[model samples]
Target: MMITQVRRPATQLARLASLPSAASRPTLNTPWRRFASGKSKSNVSSHWFRNSFGFALAGTATYLGYTYMNGDWEAWIERQKEVKKEVIDVNDLRADFIQEKRSLKSPGVYTWGSNAHKVVAPESKDSDVKIPRRFKYFNGQVLRDFKIDEKSGAAITENGDLVQWGKGYSETEYKPTKTLIGKNLTSLALSESRIVALSSNGTIYSLPISKHDQGNGPKLRESSWMPFWGRQSTLSYRVLRPSLKLGESVTLIRGGLEHVVLLTSSGRVFTAAASTEHYPSLGQLGVPGLSFITRPSGPVDTCHEVTSLKGSKITQIASGDYHSLALSNDGRLFAWGDNSFGQLGVEFLPEHPFNDTPSALPLKKLYRLSIYSPKVTSIAAGGANTFFTVDSKRILGPEEDTTKVRDLGRITADTWSCGRGVWGTLGAGKWIHLQDSPIKVKDLSGLGEYDEKTKQMLPIRLRTMSVGTTHVAALLNNKTNLSAKNTDALDKSSDWGYEAFWWGGNENFQLGTGKRANLARPAYIKAPSESSKTPEPEARLQIMPRHKGKVGKRNVSMEQRVECGRHVSAIYSAV
Candidate 1:
């Protein structure tokens, strides 16, 4: 009778109240209800349980809603399961191209700073060397022709063999090794990342190099591929036919950053681009304006002949980072592409309709420059500037040794530069910065001696000059010393007496002045000696003892070939 009087549990009361009606309550036969009813009841409050249950339900709803809305739930799960790429140490992959221990047997070449490996001794670690050591591999071989770019270099041997060496992938060690063994490359030209070799038969071959993705061989693509997710990806390199017509023979090959200009034996010019889709504005291919067309497609992969110069005979072709220059047989220079720096030498009118459309059509034609007296003989295009070597004899007065000028036919040329002069590259003295038209480099006169009485430096004549991104190198006229009173001194001499002058930016010691300072005026570079102390066994063994002394002392005054790269300069010494 006492047990029957006990009241119903509070949980039961609460459960009954939560239901819509008594009929909605769970049946006693339900498994969950039966299990709950059998468990020992606690004295916990119903309000606290209700609050806890509400929070748990709200959190679960929020998580499910967010995942459903984002649409990346599967991607998130995939990322979580991805395995990370293994980190590699590049040093372990490095292998020496030269022997670890070697001796310097000859002083055939010298280099400085970052790209010293191109010519410096492989076993040597010095950044600069006054006396260049000879490469053991090319000990007895003479370097016939050589060209270098920012990071790589190619040299042609007298035997028509080409050798290449530079900083390989990951800045790993790479020795100077022979390449294109049987190709018989007579000459080679180097660009930022490409090498164009001119075979003895006037056939041109190009090899493009990539600093990344060594596993994949060089592959050609219709369009440049973008990096994955905006991250830098490995670049692929390969050798391919340079967009030429079938059986086309290339007499001259010039390379730009992403394009190549080819000159045929018939004096016709053609240009080919590496990736037109990526750099459509470069106008490197010299293709006509196709603005009326709607997204034209198909084989933009071929080289296009420059139709503008149809009747003109192009004698020389040169390319900059983004522009192309062609010098006609009549000494007429034509430039096009990327005129932002006025590199094209074209003036824009204020009222000219501007479309901002980069195309090869409607080309800018420049007829005259500031130095109008002398005609331009040679043209050179740098990163953002243009250079021309003018006939100094035409500009010189009647009394300025006309006899010497006639003797050295087109040999005494003065360099005129235009466009960007940020690092005093124009060599027009310190006051002038940029020159829209070609301006004479007043300070680049020939070698001279300081006159104490007049308190002025007498200038010598310049034989040849070369221009880099922001530097200039001039070869002084050794045939005639302008400072000497007698005109007979201008007589051609076997004694190599000309001096090499370098100026402008020397940050990389490209000026070869053994300093990192920029020179507003030209500075002299000393010639490498071939004394017994500076032994060149190859030259010694090849020559008779009487001619041994004359081997390395050949005519340095004849024509000192100067070549300039990004921040480096080189002189071609046949000896």
Candidate 2:
């Protein structure tokens, strides 16, 4: 088509592109660069596109250098200072929990640690208690089975009256409000929003916290209906007549955040939903059907028996906030529910983080408790940890007598523990969580039994032990090993052998060892100061009144009680 001597546009463009590569095009001025057909990029330093890229690269380097000058994130920086918790030998913690450990004769109640919400009496002082001080309100009252937590407290007085206190429990922030929960209730347990009590005649009762927890709260609700769940709130403690076989009656009861564990006199184990509509089933119920996937639609009033341990005669039972343990008469230990911190005493598996079925702890294979089959006589669960007292060698000395006067206190067990190891709560050392096997709590163990050959009492025997979320408290019965000459010169002061030894987490000064630092092993805690009014500003150390009582002298020591809650510790030493 050269009729008019004009070439097609494509042909003309191709001919131009074929011209000498570098001498053909001209440069344009704009925000961006545009290259012509045969031109080579020469003065790109002045080009807008190249200049913008250079500016971006330089700015990136400058920002990186600025970032390097400053510290990393606050959390990261703090994390660097934290060394993984190792086995710290707390030489002070395991001195002993005492026997005959009841101050009922004088009824002294001591409270220490986090006082937030005034869970303990002296409500005016809002500061955390750094030392164990006698509880203010109960001067003349005789409270038994006294249990408390961050929110509330419940106890059965000597008169068989049920009382509740705290802004979280009965809305009585400053005083102990008497709540006639149920007639003849012997013992009770407290949770954040629920309270459970057991009657001597094998009945169960429950009380829900009205002010703190909305009754039948949303999460615990069943069905989508708004009114049904809302009306589920209960004010008075009502008897939970959980269906039992003809002769089955609950002999023991313990409470958790959302459930209550029941051990029947018949050696059967059962669990019922203690809280409704607010908590999810985390296998704490120990019932296969009650789980996150098949949560109950409403209040699970039925007592679902622990099926996995069906045939065994479960003698002792314990519960943490989310886990449960059952001890059989044969000294076999079974655990279920939450194992997030290895509280179940079994190795945690990623595929199975929590367990609903009861499983045995590998005592011989893993822990090697004395190279023999573990004789797990007693077990305790709290927070995310477990405590076990193995009667490895049966020490038979005392005769069983039901009379209170004949009560000689409990045996100091060979302590073993596993699970969340923070603050040395496991009593093995400040260790990583979920120890592969239960470790011998040297501080709490190694003593408590009468040496068969020596026929002599150990220095101290763990009489009473309280396992809390982050700490443990023991009332050690101080044994007298002095000669007859030393006995005559005994100092009969108000504070004899230190009444208590505390170990583990002190975040809220719960350990009451005076210093907030936790004791990985056993450490000595001073008896409360005798000074009143203006309490001494500093902690004082008293070397145990140089051994006085004769080696076999009848220990006329005043009995004391040791108890601890989430962040509170108590030593009832009214004597």
Which candidate leads in TM-score?
2
Clashes of each: 2, 19
Query: Per the 3 Å backbone cut-off, how many clashing residue pairs does candidate 1 have?
Result: 2
> Which residue runs does candidate 1 get wrong by more than 4 Å?
1-107, 116-122, 127-137, 168-170, 210-248, 274-280, 290-301, 348-374, 392-414, 431-433, 445-463, 477-493, 528-560
Instruction: Please give, for residues 1-575, the per-residue lDDT of candidate 1 as tens digits.
Output: 32223222333444444445666545766546645677433323464588567655655455545555767567656666663323223542211101101111221333433455443434567554332234455543345577755566668866687676666322564567665556577776665555667787776655554334333544444233454434322333344344455666778877777677889877888776543224435555565563214224544434567777777788888777777788878667777766655566555333521212222221112223222244457777877777766553323444566555543332334666666777877777663454556666766533355556677544445555566777876665543223433211122211223455677777777776656778877766544333547422121001100011112433221122467777766544332
Candidate 2 lDDT, 1-575, residue by residue in tens: 23223224433444444444665454455214444343345655456476466555655454444444554345444665664323233532222212111131233577888877677654656668787666666654444567878776666765566776766754544367666533577777766567778877877777675544433333221233555554332344456766688988888887777778888888988887777444536688777756644754655555677888877899989988888999999889998888788888787887877888888887666343332334776788788888887755423235533454332333344778888886788877665756747778887675654655578554344555678888887655454333322233233323334345668899888877768887787676655653577333233222222222221233322334566788887654311
Model 1 Cα shift for residue 274 (angstroms): 4.6
- Report the error of model 1 at residue 460, Å: 8.6
RMSD of each: 29.0, 25.8
lDDT of 1: 0.54
Task: State the TM-score for model 2.
Answer: 0.65
Window of ten residues with lowest summed lDDT in model 1: 539-548
